[model samples]
Target chain A: SQQGEEDPQALSIQEGENATMNCSYKTSINNLQWYRQNSGRGLVHLILIRSNEREKHSGRLRVTLDTSKKSSSLLITASRAADTASYFCATVGFMDMGRRALTFGSGTRLQVQP
Target chain B: DAGITQSPRHKVTETGTPVTLRCHQTENHRYMYWYRQDPGHGLRLIHYSYGVKDTDKGEVSDGYSVSRSKTEDFLLTLESATSSQTSVYFCATQAGGQGETQYFGPGTRLLVL
Candidate 1:
């Protein structure tokens, strides 16, 4: 079962603009991570934010996590054509045996047109 | 981009036949995972391993089995392939820490007819 769900199943933007996507999960998570996938290929890890952390930034990417609402959002500033891809949010939950696995959201397909 | 590789990037097999997908990593990551992606289902975990010979099931592990006999290799086996199991499979490795990231492979596309 998928524990996370991302809104705006698809998004289209122009190059040099900003793109934002949102994700929501059901259970308590230790961390939330964002990933990008190009077409039919595999996923690439973008950024990870811990539950205790509210916001983080790397380059033009910004991620905000709200533990109270069980949600997280990713913001891409100054988007480029190369940034066109499918973005997904994965939740890392705590298991009883100190183990953890990622539960991914449905993903948001973003198309950046130049 | 971790040093992870999945074998048989694309495969087409018949139903009731056994199929195995291999995931190899050169990063020596202690944790590895297998996941399947469908059209609208996103990605679901199939199995994962923490160490050699230690494996556990995931949410969609009913028709799949996994083995990790080495630190760099993890194998996912489908006892009997079915149409429902036709999807892209991805392998990932996780860095050990409180809030670490997972690196994914290029993924294997499997089609069961």
Candidate 2:
């Protein structure tokens, strides 16, 4: 069972357009985070949104968390070709047994066309 | 950068051979983790250590093992590599708390022939 599952496994957009990606999780979480990975490289932390935060913005990236729905969305405004990469959503679940490890979603491959 | 490094960024080994991948961190973080990434499975945890010599199995620890003998170094070994084990392995560390974000090292690409 996956803690976070991303929708639209792949996405494509124009450089100046906006791109939105969604992630849904199954369990109650302490926090949610987003990471970006360029092809064949390590993942870079993008944003972290706690369960108490309804929305967060880092640069042109916006993250929204809906604990009520166990879902979150990431939006990148005015997307650039440099933003092309695989984006992943990870969840740190509320500890039912004091064991909490970050679980990652498969991710969405975003491609920005120039 | 997190001061985390993974050695032998790429490895190609034959089946049934023993291979070890190393992760070294300079941040002195308490938690270190090993994960394998597959095309459709995302990043699945293989093992983790909470402190030196304190290790635990993860969601996908079938044929993998890990050891952390020092605060700065963690090792993952495949006792007998199988073709099924061919995948990208990533190492991560957290500062030890709930909801703390993790930093990842450049992954090691392992191919078991």
Query: Which one is best on TM-score?
Result: 1
List the TM values for chain B, per candidate. 0.97, 0.97
Q: How well does model 2 score by local distance difference test?
A: 0.91
* lDDT, model 1: 0.91
Docking class of 2: medium
Docking class of predicted structure 1: high
Model 1 chain A scores worst on lDDT over the 10 consecutive residues at: A92-101
In candidate 2, what are the lDDT values of residues B1-113, reduced to their tens digit? 48899998999999999999999999988888998999987898899988999999889999999999999999999999999999999999887765377889999999999
TM-score of 1: 0.97
Candidate 2 chain B least-lDDT 10 residues = B94-103
DockQ (CA atoms), all models? 0.81, 0.70
Model 2 lDDT tens row, A1-114 = 468899879999999999999999999888898999999988889999999999999999999999999999999999999999999999988862244567899999999999
